[model samples]
Target: MNIVKVDVFQARLPLIEPFIISYVRLDDMPTIFTRIELDNGIVGWGEAVPDQNVTGETWHSTYDVIVHELAPLLIGKSPFQIDAIHQQWDAQILGSPSAKAALDIALYDAMGKCANLPLYELLGGRAHDTLMVPRVISIKTPQEMAEDAKRYVAEGYKHIKIKVGTDAKADIARICQVRDAIGEDAYLRVDANQGWSRTEALQVIEATQHCAVEWYEQPVKAHDYRTMRHIRESVSSAIMIDEGVQSMHDLTEVIREEAADMLNIKLMKAGGIYRALGLASLAESANMPCQVGSMVESAIATMAGAHLSMSRTIIETNEMVGPLMFTQDVAGVPFDGEQLLLTKAPGLGIEVDETYVSSITVQRACIE
Candidate 1:
């Protein structure tokens, strides 16, 4: 059960289209994929989508931390001792959550494989066999956004998350246009990505009140809890904090201040499933709903997210559409339209194709 070898593969996958949030635009998704081989010959996989704007990490930094820092700490360690490993990581590593997340996922995957169980079962067992994931429409013109919405809806997606936080007036128009194109039955949500000022957030929310937005996410900056509370109180739509809630402590603070109505938990931000479970538990205790989300990642990370999403009934939405956004997947798993079917196979329940991975891999390393 002790980790004997670790392999890190860096790959760049071209997106089906350019994904634009308020802070950044990406035409290709750069991911750090880690494979940990244990003493008994069992292998586990993990993926990291490093975003400098969100996790304060890039591919190079993530790779360096995994190879030079985290790998030595992980080698010869039992995968079952996840809590101790996490504690050591928190003690030694300060802010490289994305880097730590890759290792965390790999360890969990190894544990699941060792026990011959799926990750969701290891987390807490499955609450649902399938998850209805929401497709995200990146920032674009009103017409283009509407078209994207329509296309996704036509493809059997029932939920769509629109990116906003640019011009208040244009943002309103974008929501309204997409709402019109998708009709009233499909659920519509908007993520501002902490792109707008409090005043602008309030103005846009008020203007788009008629568009029936299910929720408004991270309207202001991540640290401005006061303004987040103000905007939440000012609007009827539920307010979800994504960038704001990075840890259990952050979630506790947001709940204590009554800053947001919902929480968006991502493995990259929370570090891994270990911390993500804590955040979800804290949010549930506070009666705040949760949404499981991820960066633009391949199937490795997206499958990890799907395990977490299915493990808890408190997660009301799934935003693990990263695999769907790409033209190809580095791994293979069953996907029924927007819903990803959970596998009974061990670990994350997906198999990584090393051949395809190597084809797209830009960098690689092995630590033994």
Candidate 2:
């Protein structure tokens, strides 16, 4: 079907509470939500949550590029030609994955609706129907963080992701405290968010070995493959690359170096669903397990990751707890504790609440 209209809405959604990582603190998430309508009267939804540290984009930049630069390219184009449109975007634009991701997701939604198929069906049938999601405990005091971990575990969560890397000794204390609180059974994944030096990464990972961490993610800087390899070799826990591997090229480099045991594939970082599948393929060939994560996104991007996570068995973990942390969710889907049930509904399966969208939107633009 021919595409006709591109509507971009810029919204800042508040977190239920402040979210602090190694690099920055966020009280609210700035996002670009997209709606693409075809001449056949089908409408598709997409979203872009630009993390300045990860995607190298701001919400304002993502919105501008999508509405001004990318929307023109979508006008009159077939929504089903996903791959060709990506190639076109690459030829015309340089590096704005966040901007392109919004459009890419929107295009895929339209394609799925047009074909009357669920997203995972289009990606090849799903490997698993239910995903065990991990709740995140942001950087906080060791006691506070441990209590948070206990709260999640009490709520029947089997997986917990503890954010660290702001301080090495404090991080060690945080992990140890959480491990003690959650006991040895619940899965704990530590994400440093590239917050330490090579030496510090080694020290923190080593000191927390007794905690039985499922994985240590992005301990050092994104470019430090040598150190990552060293830590991977040194640690008893698995070492994962989140900020380290953004593209297939980055994945290739990490593979060449044998740096990481796992990869975190975010739709925003990998560009979108199509390219994320490409990343999953490369990771599969390399025998690297992947975790489908989010940049604290809404239900739109979160479900996109969930659908993709189901498409591949290699994706061992789901850390896409973005909508869970939001003060309000426009998706109108019920999320029980830690267990994410996938729907077979066409497209992303969750309809966006434009009424709720109108409340949070700070800016809006429409392209025809």
| CA-lDDT, candidates in order | 0.89, 0.89
Q: What TM-score does model 1 achieve against the real structure?
A: 0.98
| Clash totals, every prediction | 0, 0
Provide TM-scores for the models.
0.98, 0.98
Report the lDDT tens digits of candidate 1 across residue range 85-178: 9888888888788888898999988989999999999988988756888889999999999999999999998999999988888998999999
Query: Looking at candidate 2, what is the lDDT of residue 94?
Result: 78
- In model 2, which range of ten residues has the least summed lDDT? 332-341
Model 1 regions lying over 4 Å from their true place: none
> RMSD of candidate 2 to the true fold?
1.0
Candidate 2 residues 221-286, lDDT tens each?
997899999888887789999998878899999999999999999999988998999999999999
